[model samples]
Target chain A: MKQKVYLYRAFERFWHWSQALIIFFLALSGFEIHGSFSFLGYQSAVKYHNMAAYALVILIIFAIFWHLATGEWKQYVPTAKNIKAQINYYLLGIFKNAPHPTRKTVLSKLNPLQRLVYLGFKILIIPTMVLSGLLYMFYRYPQNGSIEGLNIESIKTIALFHTAGAFILVAFVIVHLYLITTGTTITSNLKAMVTGYEELEDTTKSQLESKNEVISAEVNNE
Target chain B: MKKIVISLVLIGLIIISIISFVSPKETKQSKLNELKAELSKKTTPSVDHSKFPILQKKIGSPQEVTEACISCHNGRAQEVMQSNHWNWEREEFIKGRGVVYLGKKNAINNFCIGVEGNELSCAKCHIGLGMTSSSTYSYTDSKNIDCLVCHDNTETYAKAPEKGGAPDQTLDFSFIAQHVGKPKRSNCGVCHFLGGGGNNVKHGDLETALFEPSKETDIHMASSGMNLGCTECHKTEKHLISGKMYSLSSMNRNRATCEECHTDNPHSETVLNQHTYKVACQTCHIPVYAKVNATKLDWDWSTAGKLKDGQPYEEDDKDGNHTYLSIKGNFKWGKNLKPDYIWFNGTASHYLLGDKVNDTTKALVINPLNGSYNDRNSKIIPVKIHRAKQPFDPVNRILIQPKLYAEKPGEGALWKDFNWQRASEVGMKEVNLPFSGKVSFIRTEMYWPINHMVSSKEKTVQCNECHSRDNSRLAGLKDFYMPARDFSPVIETAGTGIIFFAFAGVLIHGVIRIISTRKRKMKV
Candidate 1:
């Protein structure tokens, strides 16, 4: 049996949509600056890319604060449980109409594979992109009488790293979009993200609180 | 959700409104108004030379007029005598060769060779009179300095070609001396505009077009714009000009730069201002040279001896430019040409006479502008590279300085006899350098740094001109990484491959799931 339950909060839905829009705009403008194709023109592309970068940084800051305050960060913590089953389901069992390796609930929203992938993106890819992008924006060509140690002779390494990060992020977005269709219905995940409500497995308020408490206790033991 | 969406739309509208209101239109209007105010504030001369009593007397010869001028303005002649214009050479300290005197007298250019045995004809551009021969012309003589050439505002004083730099006998010296004032554009343009034996053949930036230029030709010298004179930027003090050409100069001293007047941080945008450290003002400002006239691009002396009906002849292109001359050579000209860019640090090295040509297979750089990306003082600058194929000694491996001009035939001038052997013998004897008695054509290049005919702000080079993937102006510059022009091939391939594979994987997986779901439904 299933019941209609609030899966995403208002702020979470807003953040998700805003990030999706910003990332798409960034990829379009970023590739233009990378000399892939000219759409907005080089000067306009640079200006808008920089503006979007600032917007993303602000959004990320708010998202981070919200996650920490709500204790929702624990959803992305990796665990070995159901990891093999999840991999097998995607590889072969999905064609056989097999059941999902794990169930989604308000207490723990992500599966083991999702947790690991999301954590890698949060800690590695996003941070690298942001840091390298900031360096690209702020780095100055050393003029006469400039400080010796502050001299950055070349931007080759920084640019290459930022470009590589962009490629990885683009690949992640492709897979993430595909994974959205693997829900109970083709549009279920999309509808949930938009309305903050989905038909999830039934769990009463008291049952969800107990499950959250048990997960917190387990985390403390580790 | 509705409130958030509405508020976001309102915020975007407000931001766009603010950006639209604060446009650059107002700034551009204010700048134009400021220029108008500056143009109206002209300096009124304190004294009129037309009323002077000394100029009322009869001026017989050009030297008599000069004497009368010296009598009133005492010690001014001494100042003009010490200038490079009067001497035609200066003491420059080359890097490897210390304390060498370099000038048109000693410097060997590919055009018309040199001025060793052809002083009579080459003296047409000289500032002094009586340069019949290089060996006989006295540099210490102060009387030879022609004061009226620079100060005559009458615009009628003309130098007779091949007459030892003398004034035309038809000119009224008395009227010119009476009307003398500050030098006009015509005074400097007379020789400089017609250098290398033709109009606009030498420096692409300087030509007759600058005399009364339109705004499109040169913003600074435009009659409708700033109307600035040559001395405005090439500031002169005691007759010693501050500007130095890399063709004759070797040291990084007394150079005229745009930064001298306009600050280094001239641009409103910090991103553009940062480019000042590595890019010169002229690199973006002067997009192309030879704005109104076609300048000489290539000259091949090997084809000079071609004659018709046993007589020297000349051929002209459709544009009235000289295409070939039996005395000179085959010529190629270009108009409104995009300048080549190179890293320059204000200093240059020249190929001095008697210097051995090490590489015979490649064109020799007559004046190699010195700098690199590693040099802190270096900046990318625009240049007009004039290439030529001139005569050289194959055995001695030295660029031969041929005597190109003679008043009559049988005088061992290439123009008169069209004999390379006789011309080379006389040229080598004049310069006192061994010529190996053998002459052959060798390719050579000369770099003329573009400095004038700067366009307005609207006509300046855009960012994509140097930042685009194809046909970038800075394509030759590979030392530093530019945003759109440079990328790592390996990283690009790898990144693209990953995206392709991920996209393919998702597409295949989606197709297989659909096929299996249909099969299960059919069985049920």
Candidate 2:
């Protein structure tokens, strides 16, 4: 019987959930800060938004360090093998209860599609929010200086980018919520994140084939 | 063969991915240090030019303040005290007809100075050099609100406002931050915290600072909280040891030219020249009055709203003299305006707008004066999508009449230094009705007088006429409404971020796959 291995470390789980919560608060409080919905009123919402942003930044710093030291960063590196198959399974095969073509193993857990998406989240979306947020926080009026050599009036662009990043986060969350449901038992995948234990299916014939191939290849070489 | 090729490609991809993932920063540590050094700029404390010993005193001490101030602006002094402004004393009334005594019953208005006697707290508003001194402040010096008193940052004055003018700059801004772009609304915010005072007073047409600028508003009500500067309009030279016209009068005393973009002839040269009012035309023409035509009706009414008493309104079918008073508020014009004529003439210039409403529909024309018009022939003004309206049309309320203002392109007499327009009544303190604290606005005509605009709330009311545009007051709130914006520059910043990572990831994966494939092929 195949059991879900101890793949994600304790810190990884902590970082994941904490990062998610912080991002969620950031988006919620950020939009409120924009006067989208007055949940905490304007001032309080601003306070929360700034706090969550700082918290998020701290998480990101820690995450960077963790990824570097553990070298688990390999998990997010995009791969082409079975990528099309993985995409196809998500689009068509999943509905038919087809098994994931790219299995989640201890060495290579994520499929190519996941690796690509994670890469995007790490590189693109994450940085967009971080940079835009920093720009928003540090944006200033020059009492005796020009704004970036370009004397163009208004910081509306900074505002627009910040808002756009917020919307992107919203979209990511919507899609993520949907994707989280498509796990093994809906409950099974969720339970893994919650309890760090996934009831993975038994190892299949491919492992046996690779094992035999490895033995025979060694014998043949001799 | 296919399996071997696939394995080789996958192995090669893994190797490159490993290396690329290991490094994200392309710049070396030394280069990063250099860049950091390039970005950091040094800052120094502001230099104070004032010689008044009080400038360096502890603020808010009664002995240092009240005693020192009254000596020069003495309550007991005669000739200097006669000027209504200097007579900071008043009596209050307990009740009935609100006895218009020499002063206020409450100390608030300095009724001794027309303040409501008990409300003496209001006396603290007029700030200046001797605020904290024990000896009487030297009143012989200009008593006008000193610009330096509030705008304390003298060291890097120019940097306070960015290129076009915005509040986006901070007091502690590095030189680099100012060079890039100014913040939109925070510049004037620190001192303009209206509610922070012991008494919460918000004196302005716009809502509280806590509220957002409504989306429905025209660019005229630009978000005041964003990129803000004190001197886009109000430039300063020295403290007003000699009384200086507040920036509001700067445009008139040394009239600031109208916006260059506003080149159309609202004021015909003949009428403009004939009407030798040195004040900005906006002052009297748009000044809030009981009625534009000297017609003071019993009730306050707008052309759009009902009577203040919650009574429904009915207007005469045609333009006629209101022989009798009605429930609707009177439509009083400024000093020489004719509301009756304006009401009748405005019928003709209805306009059409392209994209003011919903996605496909046109915008509806609303009253720009924020006043209700007398219904014509009982016909309601057409409020339709894409429909045009008053205020935008030159004919509606141009400066030609009342002839208070002028626009000289180059070197007209009025168009000179300190060309600030007057301040709105929002800045006025009703010490005793007509004779009030008209020290002019603290900032320039272009810059909003956020201080006065946020102060002087309650116990006194400034009709929109009082707060409306006037020669004394430039179309400050108007300019503040519509700031310019361009998005193209930042879009690339967003796009490049997304694509860079995606491409880098693909390149790493592809390179690793190819290398693996080549090694496997050679092994075979």
Query: How high is the CA lDDT of each candidate model?
Result: 0.86, 0.37
lDDT per residue as tens, model 1, A8-112: 998888778888998999999998988888899887888778878877887788778778988889888888777899999999989989988788777777888
Q: Give the number of the best model, judged by TM-score.
A: 1
User: What ranges in model 1 sit over 4 Å off?
Assistant: A141-145, A205-212, A216-222, B1-36
lDDT of 2 by residue, B1-524 (tens): 43453354345445554554454334344454563364344344343223345433444322233343444445433343333233332222212223322221211100011112112123233332222211233444433222222333323322111111112223322222222222222323332333112111121222233223322221222244221133332333331112211211111122222222122223322222222222222232322221111221112211222343654344431334332223222332112211111111111111111112222123222222111222211111111011111111122211100001122222211111111122111111111222122222110001111111211112112222222223212222322111111223454355445545545644564455456557767778
- Cα deviation of B292, candidate 1, in Å: 1.8
Docking tier of model 2: it is incorrect
TM-score of each: 0.93, 0.38
* Model 2 whole-model lDDT (C-alpha atoms): 0.37
Chain B TM-score (each prediction, in order): 0.93, 0.23
